[model samples]
Target: MGYTYPVRHQTGTLTTEQLHLLLKNPRLIARQVASLTNEKFLADYLLSGRYDAAGGGVYYETETGDLYTGTDPEAIEPAGDYPLIQLDEGVPSAARTVKFGQGSVITDEKISREGNQYVQKALMRVGNQMVRYVDTVAWGVIASRVSSTSAATSDGVGAWTTAGNVLGHLMTVREARAELATGLDLDTVVLPSAKWAKLVGMLVDDGALPREQGNIALSGTAPVSAFGMTWLTSPHITGTDPWLFDTAQLGGMADEKLLSEEFAAAGQTGVEASTTRISDNDSYLVRGRRVTVPIVTEPQAGVKLTGTGL
Candidate 1:
């Protein structure tokens, strides 16, 4: 009879490849939000990405395109008038930093997990925060600066409750657009969910065809096209006030340069997994500094449908 010796072997050192496999994949909530808002529209008017840490602020400039009135009725070239230029000052907001940690034990337990759910949530929070800021900037531009009063004033509280009022507001937005000498052909309006619902109901009561009511037959989120403008909904805005602005005439700015790293100290991660970690459940940091100023280059390009409960 032969006696067999029982042997067991274990490696204390973790390999780079093995460690990566055990790493949890993180979610990209920030990226998702960016896709929905920032990347989709807000970044278009970026005045500057380079925030001079020493300069303290950035300047945004806007000027109307050349004004050629009838190309000189005398059949001779008239003096070319320079565009009217305006400069806006913008200061970067404080950078938003969020930190999260994956403990050593949890790392192993979650190694088999599909992705970094925790990181995803964190990025989402950061993304949402940035978007909200953007929304704030945009809302301010429209509510405070853009002139809706010229064409229309507040309908009074609960004024948008009626179909006629809704249509009236839409007409004023068009009037606002027409006021621009070289107006951007604005074709979009943003409404709150409640306002959209009310608008749809009113349209239905008016006996308008589905297409006339924005043809919302197929999807609730489907954009409605009426009064020469496509109406969209945004949860960020108030139900009583809708934002009517020109997509062609909006401006936004963001520092696309994302500075991110994981702690090796956590390993690679990002608004994505750029901060994905490797160390014993180490922590990671994602930092983004954004200085955004939504400029109503053409104030006539936007209108705020007011008359709501303050």
Candidate 2:
């Protein structure tokens, strides 16, 4: 078989600095997805754990003291320390890479009529897709863990269309946390868009009152504060089971950071765009990968509000 000479060889023309600049788009994509994934849920509140350490794993010890008693009138015997419950969880790694051909690299039109910009968008899209994939995996892990054990169900009053019902459901979660000896910190609440739409209407009472009183309204995508915890919504999550958990104990862990790489086809040459590669046909190939794992160290730290209806 004989090989034909390509129409353009742009990759060889890119400087090291230019390549690095091209790589920045993938990073931006990663950041955007991170905001939508577990990072947003965990960073501000949950325990980071020890997953960041090389050869990832998290270790924790549970210890308690026993009450001391003695029959002697003035002397009391010392009580021995309770046995420690040591716990450890290994973090698993995940990876992905997406590749596109040359036809997409040179021929497709991007924002600025520049071929390189089109490749940048393509690579960034790969990064975004990777984030969504990992996010779903992480949440699946959480859901599985919750399924293994019983989650505190909501009172069958109704959906959160009323203030009383919303508070009642959250209170039930607080009680469940206490039953597990977990403190009532209630750090975060995540609900599906369906449930969140119902919750936002509950910010203020509809009761008619005189004009002098100031009414508070929540705006934008900011987290809502109720039942002494922050509340948020995720489009990725489905169903009406709202997750109420103490982020200090239950959250996500990563075994590795986001990874990115670009390779030029063999025997290919010319100016390569920032996030592009010259294929055998003189087009570009875009590729990316991400490594992560989901962790739920303490099941009792999370509570899911089960739904009966809307």
Candidate 3:
């Protein structure tokens, strides 16, 4: 309870200085940081260090588990103004950025002092923000070339390919950084494979969309809806499609009917890629300066979830 929640921008186009200010904002700072419970936890434990009692007393156990309570905290994530790669802005008279360490912890006031210390240290701790500006001409030139996107920004359809997969990515923010952090100038985004995995995990963990079943496929524009939230073409979505689901999945609430009524083979198959093609719409990791996250509170709790045939 005494610990602080250190919010950070994992990797965004946002600059270091701007991120600090964003964290200090009235809204962001005002957002309450509470000691919540992650009822359904996804985690791992590690022993940071341990010392045994030489006197034959009880051996002190330093076992630590990284538990994802699955209860994602609500944060008023930061945002930045202007473009990330606006070199035409003359690379500015000077530039800056901030780096922050990210992680979380649980608290147990009713427990012993040692447990409290663990909770205190583990509580949402923020790291020092490292600031960096374009130092070299090449870096500056490329930064200028992109002209307002994030370093990770790239080009693609800017649309969803599959319904379940797409929605899953929208759920959890992550242990590292908020995708839409302050200070990003996302006119030019470069999607990385690591980020894609994160995006996919965010969706799956949230239950908005289940994990990839087998071979992924796209339906012929069926009126797809999840949890009766909205209507969009279900199955697989492509960047070429004009419609962009608000906050991803056709609806914030995934349709329960599909899992109960629909056929097993509705979406795209998890086919291995054979074509050595590098096309924007081919679904490779593209840059993403920032993503538009909508206000969809209250994630729908589903039935006794069990799975097989992995």
How accurate locally, in lDDT, is each candidate?
A: 0.44, 0.45, 0.21
Tens-digit lDDT track of model 2 for 1-310: 1111111122223344454344345443333222322233322233334353234333333212111121223433587454444333234433222221221243322323554445445544553454445546667766766542223332545655566666666776576556654344556777777767655555445432123323214344535554466777666565567777766656545444323254321111110112454445444334444333556655556666765233
For 145-250, candidate 3 gives per-residue lDDT tens digits of: 2212111112221223344423322222111122433211111111223433443344445544523432112221212333333222211111221211122111
Candidate with the larger TM-score of 2 and 3: 2
lDDT of 1 by residue, 8-98 (tens): 2112333444444433333332233233233322323221122222233344444344222424343335786554534333332332222
Once fitted onto the true fold, the runs of candidate 3 whose alpha carbons sit more than 4 angstroms away are 1-92, 95-124, 128-310
Q: After superposition, how far is residue 226 of candidate 1 from its true place, in Å?
A: 3.1
Candidate with top lDDT is 2
**Candidate 1: Cα lDDT at 49:** 28
lDDT for predicted candidate 1 compared with the true structure: 0.44
TM-score of each: 0.57, 0.59, 0.15
TM-score, cand. 3 vs. native: 0.15
True-structure RMSD for candidate 1 = 13.6
Ranking by lDDT: 2, 1, 3
